[model samples]
Target: MSSSMASSLPPLPRRVGWVGTGVMGLSMATHLLSAGHSLTVFNRTASKAAPLLDKGAKLADSPRAVAEQSEVVFVIVGYPSDVRRVALDPDHGVLPGLRPGSILVDMSTSDPSLAEEIAIAAASVSCQAVDAPVSGGDRGAREGKLSIFAGGDRSTVELLSPLFEKLGVLNYMGGPGSGQRAKLGNQIAIASTMVGLVEGMVFAHRSGLDVTRWIKAIASGAAGSKSLELYGERILRRDMAAGFFVHHFVKDLGICLRECQAMGLALPGLALAQQLYLSLIAHGEGNLGTQALILAIERLNNTRLGDGGESSG
Candidate 1:
């Protein structure tokens, strides 16, 4: 809603529980703790949560433990299945430990239907659930500049604005699962943009143009995009580290395709991007960044970027 409206809402509880401390999660949770909240965190690999722990966050043994000690618990894991397990697992899920009136916020890029299920489950326990999937990759997360799309009761989502403002801009999309649908739309746009970006780079490389200069020239023009700004240099340097994992992107696109099918929509661009990304997973590059789509494109064209050599694949 409006900035004035969010400013008028009550502050979020000082006690926060965070599950999933991988790449982006670590930075996101750190912001809450930095805002002077008392944080309890849990991750499958405790070592991954070490940074947060070192920064004064408590390490909970399980998702349930985290929820018990928290008033506002957040889950931002890898897959929809993981979200189901961490938030709904009857024995150790967050729901079981949640007290009435506690808030459960899931920031994972998961199925919208699953978000609906979580909201219903939380209601049964007299707790509130909000789906708030985020955009902006690792750098944005680290800089606290993410765009958060929140879905839940309008009042509840607004109540969380103070906490969300700590992380980024918050847009309350609608009822439960709407945030996820928004995120899926985001993924669809990103998929097409990424394909276009990589293909342009490949075309530049093959034409004996200075690929680096080409990026600079077009980056500020109509051809420019956030995807280009974020991943262009990474692609140029061949740095494929997981800013956003290739495998996770494939999962997001899979969800988008399924949603599209259910809506009777055809998105050939998204379909093409999915197949290209799937090829990366097949070639054991699933752990790389989305910029690694360049690799798949290079393989298809038999031309490597920058080196003037044919792709080994």
Candidate 2:
């Protein structure tokens, strides 16, 4: 959207509840609080929720408390099992405490089947559910420019557009689990691109070419991608900080691979990328950013990317 158009976005829903305030979630929830929403937030680790509390967001005791206190509860937790525990657990989960007509929007990159299950559970409570997984990583989350892939009832998704607009581009995919499917497709593309970027950079390093210049030379060509643009400089500097964690990317790719297998499909590129990322995890570098894939490449080729100084990646 144009700058002028974005500046004119409607106000977000006033009563907002956010569960999971780690990394991207913290920034996402902060955007809603900044937009003057009466925000209530919950995180398993109390310290992670501290930043939001300092920003005037009320702290909720549990998922149920969060759901009970707000009309729209947004969840961006870790795994599919975590999503289930937070959204579907009978006693303390969000669904059990959600009021009729309330909306449950899970932004976690979880199982498509799990999303469908959550949708069905929400319906029983007269609540609406949307699987709205997002991309753009930490930078995008902090800048409120995440690309959200949503799947649910059309009217329900439309109703939450204003809130989504505050976060980033919102694309309505289809029904129930479609959002997770879209996110899986996104991960597949990302994994492939990451491999390409790392291999290209490794080749540059071996050729004794200036890695930074090499990236700039082809960044706008057919070789360019969001991953390359966002991570190229970091690779050159050997900065492997977790903008998007390696382990999380592994989780996403694992989900995509399982889905592909279940569909009787084979994507060799995605499988290769998954194997490479798993190698990184095996090396005990899973806590590093996805950009740290370069380290794995460097190890395989016996070549490093950055200047021979303080080694990080």
Candidate lDDT values, in order: 0.91, 0.88
Please list the residue runs of candidate 1 whose C-alpha ends up more than 4 Å from where it truly belongs after superposition.
Answer: 1-10, 307-313
In candidate 2, the residue pairs with backbone N, CA or C atoms under 3 Å apart (3 or more residues apart, or in different chains) clash, namely none
- CA displacement after TM-score superposition, residue 177 of candidate 2 (Å): 0.5
Q: Give the TM-score of candidate 1.
A: 0.95
lDDT for each residue of candidate 1 in 1-313, tens digit (9 for 90 to 100)? 2234333433668889999999999999999999999999999999999999899999999999999998889999999999999999999999999877788999999999999999999988877889999999998899999999999878788778888998899998999999999999999999999999999999888887888888899998999999999999888888899889999999999999999999999999999999999999999999999999999998999888763322222
List TM-score per model, in order: 0.95, 0.94
- Model 2: lDDT of residue 89: 87
Which residue pairs clash in candidate 1? none
lDDT of 1: 0.91
Output the number of the TM-score-best candidate: 1
